[model samples]
Structure formats: C-alpha cells, structure tokens
Target chain A: MARAQWPLQHGRPIIEIVLTLAQGAQKVTRRLLADTGAGAMHDPFDIVLDEVDCLMCGGKPSKMVPLGGSYSGTHPIYVIPIGIPSLGFRDSLFAVGVAAPPAGFDGIACFRFLNRFTYGNFGNANEFALET
Target chain B: MATATSIQQLNRDLADKLVEEAKLDLPSWPLGKFVGIANGHVIVVSDDLDEIVSQLERAEPDPSRTFVVEPGRDYTKVCEIWRIS
Candidate 1:
C-alpha cells in the first residue's frame, strides 16, 4: 500500500488534492483542509466547496441536499472525482456547494473521504498522512 | 449610475431575491448553471463563475449589489466557532 503525507499547517492538516473536471484536472497542490469532522454520518457530501471553486472546477450539483450543524439549510450537492496521487487514491465523491467558505480552507475533506484509509501522523507529529 | 456587477456581501435575503427572480422562468434555463442577479433582475446565467462576474460587471450598473449563485435550496452559514479559550 502506498502512503501519502503532508505537513501540518499551524496545527491543521492541509492536504493536496487533484480535482478532475470535465474541462481538465486541476491540482489543488495544497489547499484542502483534512477535517474528519466536516460531515456527519449519512451525509453524502464528502467535501465542502464554495460556489466559486465549485464553478471554476466545473463541478455541477447533481442534487440539492439539506445540511444541519452549526447552521441548518438545504444546499446544492455536487459529484466530483478527487485524487491523492501519493496515496494512490482516486474516487468519485459528493461535495456541497456553499456561498461561504468552510472555515478558512479552500475546501474541506470530510469523514467519508478521509476514513476510507488509515490516516494520522503515525508518530510523526510534524506531518500527517494516509495509508492505503 | 454605478457600473460593474459583483457577488459579495451576499445575505440570505439577497440570495432569496435572486432565486425568486430566476424561478420566474426556470423552464428556459439549463441545468447545473449558475445565475447572476443584480438590481432585482437576472443578469446572466452560465456554468462559469468568472464568466458570470465578467458579464455582470459589463451589464449591471451597480456591481456591488450583484450576486451569482446556483438557484437551488442550498445555503451555508459562515460563523466563528464559539471560543471560550
């Protein structure tokens, strides 16, 4: 199994993601925050993307879904394929389109996406990684 | 009159207004496309956010009141996590 790792940004995990869109694949070299707490169980949104990023990346919402947490509302849900080359991970995942940013990150990688493999620093406090 | 449209300071009320305007003739709009609204009217509709912004700026007189977004029941609130630390 391949392993992919990245440095902690001010104590937060900033992971590199490649968004494969109809236009082409765009590498978000280091933009998405790896937040296991992003979405709850049963939530299909594996990532949270602001409208601008969603549109620029050519992500079109396949359906409109409701979200409840710090705020409660129904939002557009998009399907997009994301890849982490280092870990040899690639999958088609669902994402939510929002007007506001998810925390301060360009995007948020949630539980469904991160839980697919074993993830943690693995004793290396300076960095975090995923093992497939 | 001010020219140039922009999608900033977007509040729920404004978002609702845009959605309402778009819903007036949803039959003509394509699926998965974002709609730009300004001055309580639909400005442009496209899948590209940059194109929406560019067109809004060129067509609308007040860009500050412009907003481009998907006309769906989707919304997210931006607020700080309660910090007692």
Candidate 2:
C-alpha cells in the first residue's frame, strides 16, 4: 500500500499533487488542488479542468453546456489522460474534462480520482492523509 | 496496465519539474489570467477561456502532455463549504 500526507493550511485541506497529460514522448505537468468537495461527478465529466489547460493538454473541445456554479453559458469538454501524484502515491486515468473551473484552481480532483484512496484529516496535527 | 505506483512516480517527476519551471516563469506572467504550459513552455496566457483553448489546440495537439496553471493564488483561497437544508 502507498500513502501520502499533506498539511492543512488555514483550516483547509490542501494537497500538493502533480497532474500529467502525456502524448507519445511529450508530457506536461502542473501542480493542482485536490478538493474533496469538488470531486463530485458532473453528470458526464469525470474531472474538471480549466479551459485553457484543457486545450493546451491536447483535449479536444467536444461541446458547450451549462455547468452552473461560478460558470455561465456552455463550457467545453475534452477527453484526455489525467495523471495525479501526491506524497508517495500516483495514478493516471482517462477522463472527461471541462474547460470552466472556478478561478484559483488549475484543476479540481473529484470523486473519480479521490475514490481510489482512504483519506481523512487530523485537525490536531493540521494534516491530511491519503492512502491506497 | 499502468499501475498506480508507476503513475504516481511519473506524475511526481512531472509536477516537480513543472513547479521548478513555474518559479522562473510565473514572475513575468500577467496577473489574473490563465496560463497554459506544454512541452515545458508557457504557451498561452489570457483571461478569455475560449481564446486560450483555441490557442492551445493549434499549438499543442497532445492533451496528455500539457499543463495549465493560474498564477499568484493559493489553491485553498476560494474553496467554500456550503450547507443545504
């Protein structure tokens, strides 16, 4: 079993994880936020990515639709290989991507990814742990 | 099959490199805009999501190897927990 832990900041759980999108010999990586709340399946999307990131990562815009929340109008969707790494744990999965994510996050790690781990926070220590 | 362990290590390497590069590049990026990185380069920076996406498609065709980021903000800054009755 692999496990990793991150410290909480200002009463919030923040994890430093890398996201990778690879094609052949080309690969791009970005640090992203792993949100326990943001992990809900948005009907058709497995994960939500910033629109600009989606395209740069080679995700093709499929369609635009209302996603509500901080987003308005239709948003672009893309199919891509999304990789996540944290502490000593890492994995990549094929998922649908949405261009519109709330400001301040490169991307959101939702249930599609979070379900793979047993996670919890230790407020006394100001840390959170994710284990597989 | 790509095991979780292998993927995790690969992603860690990629993320470390990305963070390292961003330290040098992010200082010059325009604030309050989205930035996209592909092939280890800053490819796009814009406030318009559509425009950025369009540019990325033409520039980087492989979505898997691309990275996108927002500068100068903490990941937890805007997170909100809501309660519904």
Best by lDDT: 1
Mind giving the per-residue lDDT tens digits that candidate 1 earns over A8-67?
866788677777443555465426777776765435467777766665555533345566
Clashes of 1: 7
Over 4 Å off in model 2, which ranges? A9-11, A21-29, A39-42, A60-65, A86-103, A122-125, B1-85
- What digit string (tens of lDDT, one per residue) describes model 2 on residues B1-85? 5554553344335535544565577775444455555554567777654555556667766544444444432322232212111
**By TM-score, who's the top model here?**
1
- Quote each prediction's TM-score: 0.56, 0.47
Ten-residue region with minimum lDDT total, candidate 2 chain B: B76-85
Model 1 ranges with Cα > 4 A deviation: A24-26, B1-85
Give candidate 1's TM-score: 0.56
DockQ for all candidate structures vs. native = 0.04, 0.04
